[model samples]
Target: MRITVFGATGGIGRLVVQQLLDDGHQVTAVVRTPAKLPLTHSHLTVVTGQLTDHQAVEQAVSGADAVISALGPSLKRSTTGTQVTDRTRTIVQAMEAHKVTRFIGLATPSLADPRDRPHWEHKVLPVAAGLMFPNALAELQGMTEAVTGSGLDYTIARISNPTNKPATGRIRSGFLGHDKVASTMSRADIAAFLVAQLTDSRYRRAMPAISN
Candidate 1:
């Protein structure tokens, strides 16, 4: 598969690229700074550009079989929260133009899934987040709306807090809110799951929570 990755320099995105390469897939890593991704492989092509640039996104996704996005705001409190929603609209347009169907993106669990039966923590946490980080929460909610309405074969993996630990290769994933209470997952495992979705149809057009 020829895959284009947005946010390729990010934590989970880097691992996603490496895992795709390790599995012998062609990878186009779209990023603002090429130097941030140090991995070099015969099958890897780095495309340097901002996600907000339509031409850049189009070029990166031109010949791709699938597009994966790990786009998210930085941890800094001062960051604006609209990047994910804004950039994803561009990606959806680009994908439609190029006739690419598969899209997989990373998302937080704050967005409501229709299949989820809320737990107490799930209920309280989102309310707390809305009260605390209203802008960020709203941005994520908008992003979710965009992807869900894009009319593509999209899967948004609503993940828990990601750690730097090794891949466990064992994850509890479902549309239910209480599938796992650990509320933590390793970045490597998340990458593994995203890469697997390239060919796996089990979760197509579904937003499933994933956790260790």
Candidate 2:
């Protein structure tokens, strides 16, 4: 598979790219700063560009079988303020233009999954998050809406706090409401699952929460 990846420099995105390469898939890693992705592989092609740049995004998306986005705001990058929705819209439009179907991206539980019967922590945590980080919650909600409405073969993997741990390659995953005890997932495991979804049809068009 030829895959285009946004947020290739992010914690989970880098691991996803590496795993895809290990799986013998062609990877186009799109990023604003090419140097941030310190990997060199025969199958990995680094494309330097911003997600909001349509032509850049198209270049990355062209000839790709799937697109995976782990995009999120970085505290160091002050310019990335609530731009996930805008970026997602641009990517979806480009995907439509190019006739690429599969898209997998990240989201949080704060977006309100109807199927999710909230655990006590789930119910109060997002409210606290909203109070502490109103802008982030709103942006996440916007991104969720954009992906859900894109009408493509899209899956939004909702995760909570991600840690830097080895990839266990095992996860408890289900649709938003199915898992009530999930609180954290390792970045490696999340990347593993995202790459697996490239060919898996079970979770197509679903927002499944994954955790260790």
Candidate 3:
């Protein structure tokens, strides 16, 4: 598969790109600062650009078979004024223009995947994330619209509190945040599942959550 990824400098993005290369897929990683990506592979192509740049994004999406985006704001870090929704919007537009659809995105667990979630777990958490981080919640909610409204085959892998754990390659996925600290998953597992989606057609449009 020819895969294009956004937010390739982040922890999860880097892991996913590496895993894709190891899986023998052609990888094109799109990043804001190409110098920061730091990867060398015969099959890897690193492009420097952010999502708000339409021409740059359009060019990036030109020949991709699938797109897996781990793009989002850092709750603890600061870098730019860009929102995650803008990136999703660019991916959606580029996919629409190029007739490429399969989009897999990473999102927060607070956004309920009501279908895959238990009733009470779905209710309380999203409400809390909304109450505390209203702005971030709003940004993610806007992102939900950006993906769902894109008219493409999309999957939102709503992840738990992501950690930098080894890729055990074994993890559980669902909407079960009611289990206390189990609402956290490793960053590598999220990338694993994101890449897994590309090989399995059943994941299209499903919002699956990951936890350790």
Candidate 4:
């Protein structure tokens, strides 16, 4: 399988790229700064461009088996809270133009999933995230809306409390308001789950929260 990855320089994103390569899939990493990502492999192709660069994005998305994004929130005060939303919209357009169907992206619990039952964590987490970082929350919510409405085979993995610990490969996936889900998940597990979605159809067009 050939995969195009966005946010390949990020914590979980880097792991996703490496895992994809290790799995023997061809990877096209669209990154702003190629130097930020030091991994080099025969199966990896690094494309230099921002998401806003339509031509470059199109080039990256064209003839790809799937597109995966690990984009996260930007907490900088200068940010207008639409960073992820705007960039994701560009990617969705590129995918549509190129007739690519599969898309896997990341989000937070602040973006509600219809399957989510009324739980204390669902209520409190969004509220606390909003209070602490309003802009960041808005970015995630916007991203969710864009992807869910893009009319593509999409899976939005809503993760929480991403830690830097080693990958346990034991991830608990559930709705935010459920007791089965925990508060923290390692970045490695998150990356593994996201990469696994490339071939997993169980979560197509579904938003499931994951934790460990």
Output the number of the TM-score-best candidate. 4
Query: Model 4: how far is 60 from its true place, Å?
Result: 0.3
What is the RMSD, in Å, between candidate 2 and the native fold over all Cα? 2.1
* Candidate 2 Cα misplacement greater than 4 A, ranges: 74-81, 118-122
lDDT of 3 by residue, 1-212 (tens): 99999989999899899989989999999998887788999999998876788999999888899888888765633333447877778789999999988898877766766565455656776787766666666677778888887788988887757888776777676555433335667888878888888877765776766676
For residues 13-105, write the lDDT of model 4, one tens digit per residue: 899999999999999999999999999999999999988888999999999989999998787756675767899999999999999999998
Q: Which residue pairs clash within candidate 1?
A: none
Candidates sorted by TM-score, best first: 4, 1, 2, 3
Which structure is stronger by TM-score: 3 or 4? 4
Candidates ranked, most accurate by lDDT first: 4, 1, 2, 3
Q: Highest lDDT, which number?
A: 4
Residue range 37-133, candidate 2, lDDT tens digits: 9999999999988787899898889888999999875423233366787898898889988999899998876665556665565677689867767
What does the lDDT read for residue 2 in candidate 4? 97
What's the TM-score of every candidate structure?
0.94, 0.92, 0.89, 0.96
The lDDT of model 1 is 0.86
Per-residue lDDT of 168-205 in model 1, one digit per residue for the tens? 98887886654653568999999999999998898899
What C-alpha lDDT do the candidate models reach, one value each?
Answer: 0.86, 0.84, 0.79, 0.89
